[model samples]
Target: MASLIEDYALLSDLRTGALVSESGSVDWLCFPRFDSDAAFTALLGDSEHGRWLLAPEGAVDDCEPQHPARRSERRRAARAAGEEDPLQGEAEPDPAAEGRPVVVQRTYVDSTFVLRTLWKTPDGQALVTDFMPVGDRRASIVRRVEGLAGSVRMHQEISFRFGDGAVVPWVRRHEDQKSGDTSIVAVAGPDAVVLHGDRLPQGHDHRHIGDFIVSAGEAVDFELCWFPSHRHVPARIDAGASLQETVSYWKNWSKDIPQQESYHAVVKRSLLVLRALTHEATGGIVAAPTTSLPEDFCGERNWDYRFCWLRDAALTLEAMMTHGYEKEALNWRDWLLRAVAGDPDDLQIMYGVGGERRLPERNLDHLPGYEGSLPVRAGNGAVDQYQGDVVGEVLVALEKLRNMGGVEDHFSWPLQKKLLGYVEEHIDDKDHGIWEMRGDQKHFTHSRVMMWAAFDRGVRAVREHQLDGDAARWEELRDRLREEIMEHGYSEKEGTFTQTYDDAEVDASLLVIAQVGFIEYDDPKMLGTVARLERDLMDDAGLLLRYRTSSGKDGLSGAEHPFLACSFWLVEQYARSGRIDDARKLMDQLVGYSNGLGLLAEEYDTVDGRMAGNFPQAFSHLTLIRAADAINGHGQRAI
Candidate 1:
C-alpha cells in the first residue's frame, strides 16, 4: 500500500507532476500532460500497478508503518467547547502498530519545485534530490543522489506497467552512443520511457532492480525520459544544468509577489502550487493531479479531478490576479474562450488541459482503489451537469482582472456578453449548486447569488466602465434576483438563509454571500446564517462541513470529513467581520494542517489526523491564499 496522502510532496515541470513519498517512492505520475494516462498508478492500487521506488534498502518494502492515532487539536478544542465528540463512532487506533524510528526528512527548495529528502540509517546518511526540467520540454524526471556521510547502501526498483497498469512494456537495454553508458528502455503501445542511470539495473520478473553503495564524497544521478515509442530515445541533457534553469524559472515567476507581513511566505508557496498545477501548453489549470483519492475513505466518494474545471480555473486566476499576475489572467481568459467557443447552450463544467471537450467518466475495474475505496474512476461526469455558479465565477474573476487595470479586448468583452445572455436565458431554471450535488436539482441559494453576481458585473461593465451592454435590463434582473433570493432563500422564523429555497438547511457555501457583495459580513441575516452553520455544519472536529449529508442532498453514501476550503471560507468571513482574533486563530490552525512541505489536501480526516481526498488540491490552496489576504488587509473587492 501507498503511504498516507499527507506523506507525499509534489514535483512539477508546469506540464505534469510526480507525487514522491517521503521515503523516496515516485508513486503517482502522469506523462506528457496533466490529463494523460498515468505511468505510475500505485497511488490507486498496489506496486504491481506501476511504481518507481528508489531509497535505502529496508526503508520501504519490509518494515511495518505504524500509525497510532490520538485526539487532534481540533477535537480537543471542540470537546473543551462542550460540542459533541465527532470521534465517537470512528475507528480506534490500530492495535498492530509498534514503535518505529524516524529516519527520513523532506522539504522543497525555497521558491522551486525541487524536492530534497535525506535518509538516515544506522550506518550513514544519503540525500536525494528530485525534480522535473521546465521550459525545455524534455519530458523527463531527474534524480540526484549524494552521499552525505559514511557509506550507505541504496536500492532502486521500477515496474513499467503502462496504460494505467494494464499493459506490461517490452524492456530492452542499450548503450548511449555518445556517453557510452547503459540505459533501459520500455515500450508499450505508443508510449515509452528511457531510464538512464550511472549503473543500469537488469531485468527480473518483468521489473528492473539495482543495488549500489555510496561513500562520502560520492554521487550518482538518474534520468527517466518519456516519449513516443516510434520516436528515438531522447538525448540526455546535463541534469545539473537543467536543475539550475528550472530553479531560476520558478524564482523569476514568483519574485514579484507583494509581501503580506504575517503570511507572505506561506501565500507565496500556495501561489507556486497553483502555478504548478497549470498546464503551460494551455493555460487551463487542473483541480488536482491524482484522481480517485476518495473523499470518504473506504467509501465510494472517489472521483477523478485530472481535467480542468471552469470554476476552479477561474477562481485560481482570481487568486493570482489579486497579486498582480495579469499575464496569467489573460492566458486563462484565452483558454476559456477557446473551450467554450461554441454556442453558450453547449457549455460544459470542465474541459481537458488542451480544451478537449468529451470527458466520459468510467470505472477502472482492473485497479483496486486507494485504501479499498471502490470503483477507482477516470474522467469526470460532472461535465454534463448544469452548474449555475460556473459562469458567475468566471465573470467575478474577470471583474477582478478589470479592477487591476486589465482592459477588455474585443474578444474578451464579447464573451462576457454571451455569458450574460446565457444567464438571462436560464434565469428560471433549477440546477446543481456549487457542490455539484449528485442529487436532484433544486433552487440552490448559492447558485442564485452567483447568477445575480453575473448580472451585477454585467451591469457594472456598461454603467461603470462605459462598455456596450443593456445595463437597464441587467440591473432590473439583478435587483429582482436579490429580492427573490431574500424572499425564498431566507427563514424569518430562524433569521437565517437556507441551503435551498425549499428547505431550511445551512451550507458552508452560504458563507460566501458576503464575499460576492450579496450582503455585508456582519449583517444580522448573515450573522444568523453563520450561527446556524456553526451550530449545524461545524463538526465536532471544529472544521466546517460543506453541508449536512443527513439531508440526502449529495446522493452519496457514508460521510466525508470537513472540507478544508470551507474552513478557509469561514476564516475569511471572520476576518472581514472584525473578529480578527478568531480569524487569526482559525487561520493558524488551518495553515498548520498542511504537510511539512506546506501542501494541503482536499479534506481532513480529523479522527485519524490525516489528509484525505486528492493531494495538493487547488481548491484548498486557493482558498487559503484568499483567507490569508483577508487577514493581512490585502483582500479588498470591488463589491
Candidate 2:
C-alpha cells in the first residue's frame, strides 16, 4: 500500500506534477497536462497498477538477536585482520516488512520545485533528489540518487498503467539513436514513456526491476519522458543541465514574493506549492495533484480534483496578487476569458488545464481508491452545477489585481461586463453553493453573499474605476442583495446567519461574510455566527468543519474531518477582530498541521493526526498564506 497522503512530496514542471512518497515512490502522476490520464496510478491501487519505487533493499529487524551476534562476528573478523574498524554497512531496510525504524525526511530545495528525500537507516544514508524540468515542452521527471555515507543497496522497480491504470503498455528495450544508451520504452495507444538512465531496469513479469549499489560519494541519474507513441522517442537531454535550469527558473519566479519574517519559510513554500499546481501556458491552477484521496477516508466522498475550479483558481490569483504576482493574475485572467469565451450561459465551474470542457464523472472500477475509499472517481461532475460564488470570486480577484496597480485591458473589462450580465440573468435562481453540494439546490447564504460581492465589484468597476457597466443597476442589485440576505439569510431566533435562506444551520463558509465586505469582522451578527460555528462545527482541536454532515444538507452520507481552509478563515476573522492572541494561537496550530515539507491537504484528521483529502491542496495553502498575513499585521482588509 502507498504511504499516508502527508508522506508525499510534489514535483512539478508547471504543466503537470508527480506525487512521490517519502520512501521514494512516484505513485501518482498525470502526463503532458494536469488533466491527462495518469501514467502512474499506484496512489489509487497497488504497485502492480503503476508506480516507480526506488527504496532500500533489505529487512532491518533490530529485535532479532542474530543481528547483534553477526555484528560482533564482523567486528572480531576485522580486528583479527589488524585493520581500523569501519561502520556496519547493509542494504536499506523496508520499514513495513522489517519492523525497524526507517526515517525518511523530505524538503524542497529552497524556493525551488526540486525535492530532496533522505533515507536514513541503521547502516547508511541515501539521498534522492527529484524534479521535473520546466520550460521544456516534453514532459519529463528526473531523479538523481546520491550516496552520503557507506554503501547502500537500492531497489528500483517500475510498472506503467497508462490511461489511469486502464491500459498496460507494451514494453521493449531500445538503443537511443543519439546517445546509444539502452532505454526502456513503454507504449500504449497514443501515449508513451521512455525511461533513460545509466543502467535501465530490465523487464520481468511485465514489470521492470534493477538492483544497484552506491558507495559513498557515488551518484546515479534517471529520467522518464512522455511523448506520443507514434512519434519518435524524444532525444535525451543532459540531466545536470536540466536540474540547473529548473532550479534557476523557480528561484527567479520566487524572487518577488514579499517576506513575512515570522512565517517566511512557510509562506515561501506555500507560494511555491501554488505555483507548482499552476499550468504555465494555460495559467490554470489545479485544486490538487492526486485525486480520489477521500475527504472522508473509506467513504464515498472522494472526487477527482485534477480539473481547475474557477473559484479556487480565482482565490489563488488573489493570494498571488497580494504577494506581488500580478503577472500570474493577468495570465489566469486571460485563461478565464478564453475558457468561458462562448455564451455566458455556458460557463463551467471548472475546466481542463488547457481550457477543454466536458468532464464527465465516472468510476475507475479497475483501481481501488486511496485507503479503499471505493468508487474512485474522475472528471468532477461539479462542472455542471451552478456555483454562484464563482463569478464573485473572479471579480474579487481582478479587483484585488487592479488595486495592486494592474491595468484592465479591453478584453478583461468586457468579460467582467458579460459576467455581470450573467449574474443579472440568474439572479433569482437557486444553485449549488461554494462546497458544490450534491443535495438539492437552495439559496445558500454564502452564495448570496458572493452574488452581492459580484455586483459590488461590478458597481465599483463603473463608478470607481470609470469602466463600462450599468453602475446604477449593479448598485441597485447590490443593495437589494444585502437586503435580501439580511432579511432571509439571518435568523433572529438563532442570533446568527444560517447555512441557507430557508434553514438556520451554521456553515464554516459563513466565516467569509466579513472577508467579502458584507459585514464587520466584529459585528454582533458575525460574532453570533462564529459562536454558532464553534459550538456546532468545531472539532475537539478548535478546527472547523465545513458543516454538519448530520444535517444532511450536502446530500452525502459519512462524516468528514475539519477543513484546513475553514480553520484558517477563522484565524483571519480572529485577527481582524482584535483577538490577536487567539489568532496567533490558532495560526500556530494550523501551520503546525502542514507536512514535514510545509504542505497541506484539503482536510486534516486531527484525531488520526494525518492529512486527509487531496495532497498539496491549493485551497489550504492559499488560505494559509492569507492567515499568516493577517496574523503578522498585514491582513487588515477594509470592510
lDDT tens per residue, model 2, 128-181: 889999997769999898989887778899997798988989998888776788
The digit string of per-residue lDDT tens for model 1 on 1-639 reads 777899888999888999998767898999988888989998888788988888877666422323221244335456669998756687753322322213566888879999998877667889899999999987889998899899888889899878887789999987879878778899998999999888667788988899899878888989999999999888777888998999899999999999897888789999999999999878999999989998887789998889899999998998998888999888898999999998999888899999999999999999988877888988988889998888889999999888888889988999899999999999999998999899999999999999999999999989878999999999999999999999999999989999999588989999888899999888899989988999999877789999988789888898888999999999998888878898898899898899999999999988667899998999999999999988888345424
Q: List the candidate 1 regions with Cα displacement exceeding 4 Å.
A: 62-104, 634-639
Error of 2 at 203 (Å): 1.0
Off by over 4 Å in 2: 59-101, 121-123
lDDT of each: 0.87, 0.86
Estimate the TM-score for candidate 1: 0.94
Poorest stretch of ten by lDDT in candidate 1: 62-71
TM-score of each: 0.94, 0.93
lDDT for residue 360 in candidate 1, whole number 0-100: 95
